[model samples]
Target: MPPRPPQKPNRRMRGFEPASGLLRDRIRTVGEARGFAVSRLLTHWAEVVGEDLAARTRPVKVGYGKGGFGATLTLLTMGASAPMVQMELPKIREKVNACYGYNAISKVLITQTAPMGFAEGQAGFGPAPKAPPKQTDPAIRQRAEETAQVVQDGGLRAALELLAQNVLSRSANRAVTKKG
Candidate 1:
């Protein structure tokens, strides 16, 4: 046989795989078999259930009968909120089914747990405290007020001065924080 030229790698084949894309097939296989659209349900839990309910509960899994389709959704909730969630089962089921575009869920089973519910992996942390509003230099504030005095509207003049003051103050705080 004659020698052949070296073939270049296909550029189309080279691409980044998203973290989620790698697990998608596995999630679909396990989730669908159990009658749960796990990825969709988890991603849109807040939309499927109201914000209030979603905050208090987490979807655990779905169990289907031998016939299939009409599966029971298992939800994990804090003991205190379980009763409230129990009352809203019908509403939750309807919303979930709507997301699935069919009557995919027939029942919602509430499982109560300790106030600290199931941990997906790492422990959850509370939101950080907001930084306090920065204080502007008196000279800068005076200059901003004097410059904004050109605007005839009282509200506009005050707003302009305040905006300038805020921008300067925030920049000053950023510089100080970066130094420290």
Candidate 2:
């Protein structure tokens, strides 16, 4: 056998230390999932309200509600003029209801809690939307699986849109990744 040349040290394998390997991997997974969920939610907003409105409203809070069936989103309206939130609350409610395939949403509470320094320039009466109620159903699980597959196969953006619609329709929170 011929003597082999010394291989150059690679950074890819060295960058991630074994001490935090498990934690790092878990964090990565979580980040990706959160990103997907946010994307999906934004798409839903855009479809309901217009691209312009969606762009203006940024999500400020997101979390899985009780029983892990519903996802809540609180968004802050960037720039507005005179009680825009109040005027838009009904439309938002309608859109949310329609998105969930019915009136599955128990509440669409809105509040005025803009970030510090934002309120002075902002012009809205109502608060940001609160979390939707928890939901539990076989249909929601099935949809989560389907949505997860779409995300795994089609990259982040496509999966997000799929997930957003499914979550809205089913009023569910879990994002089930495809097994195998």
Candidate 3:
């Protein structure tokens, strides 16, 4: 198979596209309509799914697909969970339709994505998995503190101390025990 093209950085839409006279008003109206759909979708999504999931989901791009009978909603999601999408999408679609007066939007398509990973790591993703918390036990903490204190005494001194106390002591202990 052929290699995929390199992904480009996403840029913000500054304002309405340039159009003349009557067309300009139509353009602005369309932009506003789409914006309304996005806003309402976000709100509805938060209510339906959850704020945490909603925050992870965003409308990256929205436009007419193929012949323009349907609206394509490109969502940048952190991960692909089919059941989660199934639960959230219908509500989002209904909200979009309501926002547009239930006229212009024929359908809503959800495309999951990971913009950062796509741009930085060149990977299309749903979402990055949450990392586990670091270890924080007292024993580990004490060991780290002891090492830090020894290093503070100077690298050579620390190294000698470790060698004599750990390596050499273990060897001498073994020898003494074996002899006894």
Q: For model 3, how does the per-residue alpha-carbon lDDT over 142-173 read when each residue is reduced to its tens digit?
A: 54446556454577656655444454445656
**Tens digits of per-residue lDDT for model 1 on 129-162?**
7999766799879978888989999999999999
TM-score, per-candidate, Cα-based:
0.53, 0.33, 0.41
The global Cα lDDT (0 to 1) of model 1 is 0.79
- lDDT of each model, Cα atoms only? 0.79, 0.52, 0.56
lDDT of 2 at 127: 54
How many residue-pair clashes does candidate 2 contain?
3
**Residue 4, candidate 1: how far off, in angstroms?**
21
After superposition, the stretches of candidate 3 with alpha carbons farther than 4 Å from their true spots are 1-53, 65-68, 80-83, 115-144, 152-180
* lDDT by residue (tens digit), candidate 2, 1-180: 999999996756746566555465565455346532433344355786666555455434444567654555455653342266657666665676566565534434443444343643353334558999645465655655565664455567466755656666644333333331
TM-score for candidate 2: 0.33
Model 1 residue 155 lDDT score: 93
Lowest summed lDDT over 10 consecutive residues: which window, candidate 2? 171-180
TM-score rank order = 1, 3, 2
RMSD, each candidate, Å?
14.7, 24.4, 15.1
